[model samples]
Structure formats: C-alpha cells, structure tokens
Target: MTIQLPTEIWWRILDYLPSNKVKQLGRVNRAFLEKARQSRYQSLVIYEYDKKTKRRLKKIRSSSLGHYVRSLTLCVQAWPASDLIRWDGQTGDSLSVVDRVRSLFDSHYLPRKTVALKKKRLDRRIELIFEAMTAFEHIQEYELIWEEYDQDCPEEFIPEVKFASSLMTIFLSMLVISPLRGTLTKLSLQIPTHIALDCLAAADFPFLEDLKVFLWKSQCSRAKDWDILTGYLGSENLAKFISGLSSTLQTLSISRLDPSINLDRDFGRVFDLLCRTNFPFLRSFDFCTRSRYLRKGTPSLDRFVRQISHSVRSLKLSHLAYDTSSSSPLHHLDHRSWISNVLSVQGLQTRAFSSLTSLRIKDGSLSAHLADLSALLTSVAHQLVSFFLEDNLLTLKEVETVVCSLSHSSSPLRYLGIEPRDLAPDTFDLLVCAFPGLRELSLSFERFTSSDDDVIPMTEEDVRCMFPNLCLDLGFFCFGLMNTAGATADGIICLRLRSAVSLEIELCLMR
Candidate 1:
C-alpha cells in the first residue's frame, strides 16, 4: 500500500461523473470501490427470481460495492403455476433434506402468510427474495410492491395459497425489515393490518425514521375469503401492530381508497396510538379515510387532532367525513364543521396558527363555510399566512362575515384562494374589500349568470378601489406583461369566471 490518488477529491470528481462512470470506477480496485461507494451502488431494484437475482447477488457480494447500497425496492409478483414447475427440476436436485424441512417450517411458522401464486411458487419466491435481499447489508430504505393487480390472475383458484400468495409480498416485507434492522432508516411497506401488526410487534428497526404503509383492499378481502387480516383483525390489533414504530418513526403516510368500510376500528386505533405514543420528533402525519363520520369515531378523531395540533408541523387528511345521519351521497355540510372547528381551534380574535404551517384538506362534499373560515383565519392568519379554499361562495352574507370578522385582526392573512359559485360583482368587490392587507388572492367564479345582476364588470380603477393593495390578473389584459407595473400582492390576481348552469360548486375538503 504505497502512495495513491487523494481520497478527498473523489467525491468532487464523482459529482460530475455519470452512473456508468461511477460503476466503472467502483470496479477499478479496492481503493476506488471504498472511495466511490456512496455514488457507485446507491439504488437497486430487485425482482423475485432465482437466476437473475442469484447472478446479481453474486456480482454484488463479490464486489466491494454491495456494502454501499442505500435504497432497495423489492417488487414481488406472482408467476403462473407453469413457472413453478420450471424451478422443480433445479430445486429437486439442489434442495437438501434440511432445506426441505426448513421450507416446511417456514410455511408453518411464518405468520400464516400467503403469496399471489400457488404455495410452491410462493414459497420459492419468498426464499429467493430473502436470499437476494440478505446480500445488501447497508440499505437504509426498503419498499415492497406486490404486483397482483398488474399481471394476469389465475381464473381457477385454490383458496389456500391464493390468499397466501397475496400475502407473500407482506411476508417478504417483514423479511426485508429483518436484514436492515440495524441500518434501515425508512421503510415503505404494504402489509395487511393483521400481518404487519404481528410482524412488526416482534421486529425492531433501531435507526428507522420513516414508515409508510398502504392499507390494501380490505373490502375485497372481506367479501371473498375468511382471511386473517380482515376476518378477525380489528383496529385495536392494527394499532398495537403499528405501535412498534412509535419510538423511531418520524414521518408516516398511510393511503387507501378507504379501509374503514371493513376496518373502521383500525382507523380509530390509529388516533389511539397517536394519543398514547409521544413521538416528540414526529413532524408530519398524513392519513386518508373514505368512510363518513360515523358516531364515536369523529369525537375521538377530533380529540386526536386537538392533541397533535400543537405538535405535528404538517398534516394532510382526506375523505375524513361522511353523513352519519343520511345515507345519501350528498353530505350535509354542517356535520363537517366540527372537524374544521377542531383543526383551527383558537380564541375569539385573529392570531397565528401555532403548530401547523401548511394544510391541504380534500373532502369532496365539504367546506368550513365563510363564518367558521373567517374565525380560523382570524386565529391563524399570522402564522398560517397561506391557505387554499374551494367553496361555493354564492352569498354576500358569508362574504360580509369574512370581512367583518378577520379584516381588523392583527394576524391579517397574506395569501388566500376562494372558488365561489354564483359570482356577483358586488360580492367579489366585497371579498376583496374584506382582506384589506391581503398580499395575494386567487378567486374563481363559476356558474356565471349572463343576467345584468351577475354580469357587472369592474374597471381597473374599480378593481383597485376594491383591492387597495392588490393588482388584478386580467388574463389577456389590455397591455403586455411590462405594461402591468402597478400590480400588487405577488404582482397579479386572476378572476376565473365561467358561465354555465350545469357546473355545481363542489368543495372537495376532508369529509
């Protein structure tokens, strides 16, 4: 080990080099591999197969770059039963008596799991995935994607492995976590509540900081088979399942079409976990549910929001409420007000929205109304200076409340977006008049009436009179961009008014 090239300059040089060049440098020698490890083998996508994966594993294991992999994605998909026989020829001769015995034990002891294919294929795939994944020892993030829906399904199915095959991805998900426990910092996995809860309870990720779990199709699972995840798995079990990540997880996003139809208790359990667990460093919590506001659950959810309001910095919730009283698709807006009230809780006067800086609510059948919204802005305008609201702004009365309530508050809002139905010249004028200190505003006027009452337009001076410190966007205005020098509030505003009776103002807020 005599003199060599300076190691400190390698990073700077690698910055300008492409990926192929980095791989090229990694193969140069032991020194080059060690120095270029970070950029050489940064990401890897593994498909579940024997030969391809075996070859890759062999290459990475023999090379020094295998220790440098930081992110690994395992996309486990099902193969037809025909493919299962192809492995028989190879495995029949290769599998030892102990190996066969271990496979039997895996089926018996591995959480009663399933894959998307026959048990034989599922078992083989799981074994192959585990074997390949164990080679990458330095991975920090792991993602497991099941391709059940992406490929053709077996029309004739056996109940046993069909369910197990579906769960093979989850089983592999647990296995993926085991190898990376000491080094993993992020895990984005898709495991059913029943499986994940059990697997995670026993597993520990010392350095794991982020965990994203996608709650899969519970309705179909419940409808078709007596599956463990849906048939017997309840929210309490699900909560206990996720609690394993409480100490380490700082960011979480669990998205679904809406699992509450089958697992309402699971949704409740999430809030319960939040209430009981004190994750001091947890900065963001993102959750989505499709069920309407059933009784008991809303109150607990409200309480959860109240607790996390002062802690979590960013929150995004969707499809959160539904009409508990009526079964109609149309939601009576009043029911959603409670959620809004809890989220923007404060005193009577305008102030800063303390913990939350950005919030995007998408409930197709809801809005906070002009009055409650004004209160929310009055309370949070100082700190929550920016917000986007989609509402059917049809009444002047509501517009007046916004102006009267928050206009004089110390925490005047700096940014606001409102989509109103039945656009009126006077109401639009009054809305601008309300936010005297507004720096930026976006207004969309839909369902435009050609009648004289609705068609009243405002001149530039009229606009200026209404929005004192603001400039109108004036799409395709009289002059070019340079001519609009006097624009205020981020330079311009847009009045997107459309004429039509068919369009209804649908405010997609968290239901």
Candidate 2:
C-alpha cells in the first residue's frame, strides 16, 4: 500500500519546505534526493577555496546537480599578510617569482620561508577555484567579488596588484570560454581597477543584460597610480566593453567612480559609446563620480547627455563634490579651460532625459547652477513617475520649487523622496495634498541625540504625530537605528498611510 506521486508533485512539495528541511528529506530516499537537487544547487556561493569547498565542487562535478546550478558567486580574498611584505634586493632568500610581490618600502616583517609557503598555498587555492567554476554548466548569473582583507601590520601595506591583474584576466577568459557563457545574462564584477576594466574589454557576454561595477575604497585611493601599474588608462577600454554588449545590455551602473587619468580624459567616452552604438534595449543608466567642480562645457560630456536624450527610462546621477581646497592641477586651470574640461549641465535645454520616468539625484545636486537645474527639472517634470533626491539636503524653498516643477506632470508621480532641513507641522498634509496619486513617500528628518533611547522612542512618537493615521503600521517597521551617543543617523521607520500611501521616515542627527 505504497502511494506513488509524480516527480513534478514531489518537486512542488519540496519547494514549500525550508531549504534545511529539503536537505533532510533528500537523505530519506533516492526519489527525494532527485527532487531536492534543484533546491540545493539552484544557487551557490563559494567564499573560500578550502578543502570543504573542494569536496563540494567534486560532488557537483560527479553528479547531475551541475545542470541545476543557475547562479554562482565567487569571492576571491585579498592578498595574505606574507604577500604584502617583501625583502627585495636580499641575496639567496629562495623566494619564488610566483609569490614575488612589489616591495613594501624595503620591509622584512615576515620570514622568507613563510612567504614561500603561503604563496604556494594561495596558488593551490586559486587552482581549486578554477576547478569549482567548471562544475556549473548553466550558470546564468555570475558575481566575482574581490573581498577586502585587513592589513594588520603597518609594514604589510603593499598589495599584489599585478598578480591580481593577471588572475582577473585568466578568470575572465575562463568565464567567457565556458559552457555558461551563452547562458549568462547578469555579470557583476566587484574588482574595481583599470586592470579589471582592461580584462573586461578582452571578453564578451553574448546575452548579458545587467552589468554593475562597484569601486572599492581601497581601489579608489590607488586610481592615480593605475596608469603606471596597469601600463594604460583610458575610457577606450570601457567603451570597447560596452560596445561589445550594446545590443543585449539593458542596465548599466557604475558607482563611486574616482576621477583619474582613465576617468579624466574623455570621461564621457563610455557614455558617448553607449549612445553612438545605440543600446536599443538599454533602459536604466546610473553614473556617479567624484569631482572637484562642474566642468561647464566639456564637449564629450555635453554630447553624451544629448546622445542618450531619448532612450533611457531610469536615470540616476550622483555627483559627489570633492573639496575645492584640494590641490589638483585641474582646479588651478583658468576659468575657460575649467569650463572646457568638465561635465556641466549649466545650459542643458534639449530635454536630455526626455524619456526618463525614474530619476535619483544624490550627494551633490546641480544647485550651484540654479538656472540650469531649474530648466532641466522643468523639461522632465511632465513625465517623471518616481523621483528621489538625498544626501545633499534641500532647503524648504528648494523643496517647494521641486514640488512646483513636478506638480505640472500630466501623469501623477507614484513615488517621491526628499530630505528637507526643517519639517513644519503641516508638511505631511501639504505633501499628501500635493501628490494625490502618490503611492509612496520618503522623508528624512535630522535631530540631535544623546542616546539611542532619545533617538528611537521620541522619533517614533514624532512620526506618529506627523501622520497619526499611519501609526498602526509602525508596529512592523524595520528600523536601522544607530545606538551610538553622537551617531548621525538615528533610525528609519517604514509606515503605510491611508489606503495606498507608503511612508519611509528616516531620522538623522544634525552635525
């Protein structure tokens, strides 16, 4: 009297169970094992290349579970402490070239024997990672992360940048030539450097749709030396990579872009390439860069905004203003030359974001060029659906100006986010009345706090007072609160207001 169920029904039942439960069921019988493969192997993340990882890779390669793998995340740790220091110009140290790293200002903290052994171990780990990569056949999303490692010893400061460069090149080559190349649709590379970009230029993803590049702080600090280290720095490499995937790429986001030789000369080349080649499917474009000043009339930058004037639907621009006091040669350039060298939206009149519906502006607003910012706002005011402006706080007057511009839109905006200096008692009512069709609203309030209790409970009460009808939803609010006495951010409270309005209240501390 044994009951029989179809494999599909078993799979459906397995999907409802927790992952741990599914694994437990897998051990019950062969039928259950087959049904659980999808749950167990659908996504995998390898944080290290140790013996356990090696065993998992062996099992994957030996079984049919390889076909079930769709997403793979590989995090390559930074250089070891031994790799950081080198006793260069020392005779008969028995240091292998494979483990040889750039000298850390003539430091000899680690013994030569220790360096050699660690280098050998690192080589073995890298080999294991390469082997693990081959175990997946249908990987559709691959994320390669270069995790940051702390430099404990002051003497252990030098990095294996060159070795990392070569490793990335080989990794990219393996990825593009593998069976998963055609299946891959999303690729996120967390290794931020000119070398990474150069490696990217050498490969192509046939079906890639989403690409995200994050610039690490460590990498950002060394941007000035990238040209000398990598032996080349230019936007051409990035442009070439984009051109290769122009047809299939749908989303492109480059964050924390540091101004360097590669970013300075033809900073707009990457943007301009996206336009010239014409990414028909491109819908979202996000670019954030740190600059000392706005370059008013740079042709490359001007042409870029104009070229993509009609295609992008989501645009996010973050201009992190660098301290003008910093002594960069570009800062000393004459007014005219400065005007000719940087990207400026001072006279943007063509409705550059004509097709845009969602816009996010953070860190530095184009407030300095009021006329241009106003003009730009007016042009896109008619069609914007969601808008978020934060980091750079806006005055009440500026907030009113923004609302006035957006109020004219034919279609009501569904979402609005802003940080205002002072919140009047009637601010909530004013916003609710202004955007009748708004479904979600986000506001940031700054307050000085001496303790967590002072920040949390009082802020919640303040929120309740501001939007009394939304207090019930505050019960389930996920608050990211800071407990420090003098923390800048107190907490965030999410609330549901009325029938459709969703509110996100952020509590920040004033400096």
Best by TM-score: 2
Candidate 1, which ten residues in sequence have the lowest lDDT sum? 501-510
Deviation in Å, model 1, residue 190 alpha carbon: 2.7
lDDT (C-alpha, whole model) for all candidates: 0.54, 0.62
In angstroms, how far off is 8's CA in candidate 1?
Answer: 16
List TM-scores for all candidates, in order. 0.62, 0.71
* 165-224 per-residue lDDT for model 1 (tens digits): 455535644563767778888888764433335455456676778878776543234444
After TM-score superposition, what is the CA distance of residue 506 in candidate 2 from its true location, in Å?
1.5
Per-residue accuracy of model 2 over 11-129 as CA lDDT, tens digit each:
78886898878778767767777678877888899875556777888898887678888899877545444433222323323455544453343456346555675466557656876
Candidate 2 residue-wise lDDT at 358: 92
lDDT of 2 at 317: 67
